[model samples]
Target: MGHWLDRNIVEPGKLPLLLALAAFVLTFLVTRVITRLIRAGRGPFGNIRPGGLHVHHVVPGIVLMVIGGFGSVAVRGHGPGAVVAAVLFGCGAGLVLDEFALVLHLDDVYWTEQGRKSVEIVVLTAALVGLVLAGFAPFGVNELTPDELQSRSIVVTNTLINFLVALFALAKGKPRIALIGAVVPLVALVGAVRLARPGSPWARRFYRHRPRARRKARVRAYRHDARWAAVRNRLHDLVAGAPDR
Candidate 1:
């Protein structure tokens, strides 16, 4: 059994098929157990809420976890397998930490309306998987070349932008809007990155203009806040003086 576990995991040799199968099965089992605990609703041994499910948060996380777990099964001492293993290990670590946080979040003392929406564990896991897959893809398959790390970087970056959009949408309770925002910004960001590459004509122009816009926005924000502070003070004084009237 000991050798089997290590063979199924920690050593990815002559077992690509087995590793893949185990990765998927293990991922599913782990996720179901975690989800059940999350649903059991409170103590170290309880769920986050009474029979409640964090579907959006938990499902994507489950998918990522499976991908990573199987990847772990195939990780050997070096090369692509090693990289995949490291990524899987990181995912495992994140899942453990997140589960701990979920316990805290479920506690009545720490639970807040905003806290209810935030599942840092799920977000971070998704992000990690995105990064790992991007990095692994460019190096793993024969169809891809080694020099495509830049493409991986772009993939990671775009995944982040999508995550942000999803987070914002979830917070606002507008899943459709969030989906649109997630898709649009990601497409735009990727397009921009591609256009900014060495041979593109817009690359130099985009870089030259991006910073200036940011500076202008920051200056505008400062001025706006200054004026708002003055108005706020006046309103405070008026409210304070109302009793005398």
Candidate 2:
């Protein structure tokens, strides 16, 4: 175990990344527990308010992010400083993403249905980071041969193609696939070739005049959502606690 750790993580200079991911996941889980307790009025935890203004945790999160970001830059990814900065930044990210809905809507929607966005974003962020940790490079860079990597034009072209495919997936309202596709080009390709979700930008723009296409898109979207939405919601609720009715 120790050999594998040192060989794969420490020697590769991925210790800080591993630490950061651990810190981020732990902070998010802890924060969710406390918030859930407060919501249920069963804990000492409560909202922070000063001078009649309710203070959100994201404020402190932003401060921590600034400090850690600068600290990481200053340390230049070496020594103990990098580890500390990584942990701090991870903690801050957890807090900020926990309130992502608030930032997105510019309102406190923590317990509302809209707040589910926060959980989704956090999960997506974690998954992407995990993919990185698992050695998936963005834009399929990891797939390049040594000779191909030496060719700047080839690398750029490959990245551009992958990026465009991922963008198409996003336009089709397949954000999860697009995000994963950023790391794995095959995923992006699949999503890009699939039909756009109903009301998605791609559907609205291209399917507008195509009555058959619009109907097909709507039916496909409804079937997809009906098949997976409940499972997704249950997972979200299990992780972040159910939103208020």
Candidate 3:
């Protein structure tokens, strides 16, 4: 175990990244627990307010992010300073993302259905970062041969192709797939070739002239949502607590 840790983490200079990921996840979970407890009125914790203005946690999060981001840039090597900076940045990111919906909508929507977006974004962010920690390079660069990696044109071409595919997936309303596809091109290819979701930009523009395509897209979207929406919601509730009715 120690050998694997040294080879995969320490030797590769990934200790800070690992520490950051751990800090991010732990901060998010702890924040959620505290927030949930406050919501249920079962804890000593309560919302922060000053001068009749509700102070959101994201404020402190932003400050921490700025400090840590600069500190990480200023500090060299994977030393104590780097590790501390990484942890601070991770914690700040967790706090900011926890209130992503509020930032996105410019309103307090933390306990509303719209707030689920925050949870989803946080989960996606964690997954993407975790994939990076697991050595999955963006645009599938890790899959290329040493010779291919050495060729700038070849690397650029490969990245361009994968990026376009991921962009296509995003246009098809498969943001999650597109994001994952950035690291795994095959997933983006699948999403790109699949029918666009109903009401998505791609579907609205391209399927408008094709009645059959529109119908099929709607049907597929409905079926897909019916199949997975409950499971997704349950997972969200389990992680972030149910939103206000």
Off by over 4 Å in 2: none
Model 2 scores what on Cα lDDT?
A: 0.93
lDDT of each: 0.43, 0.93, 0.93
lDDT (tens digit, per residue) of candidate 1 on 89-110: 4444444433434455654311
Q: Residue 154, candidate 2: how far off, in angstroms?
A: 1.0
**Model 2 pairs whose backbones collide:** none
**TM, every model:** 0.26, 0.98, 0.98
Clashing pairs in 1: 23-70, 38-48, 40-47, 41-47, 41-48, 42-47
Tens-digit lDDT track for model 2 on 108-155?
899889999999898889998988988899999999999999999999
Q: Count the backbone clashes (under 3 Å) in each candidate.
A: 6, 0, 0
Is candidate 1 or 2 superior in lDDT?
2
Q: Which is the winner by lDDT between candidate 2 and candidate 3?
A: 3
Model 1, CA-based lDDT: 0.43
Candidate 3, residues 161-188: lDDT per residue as tens digits? 9999999999999999999999989999
Cand. 3 Cα-lDDT: 0.93
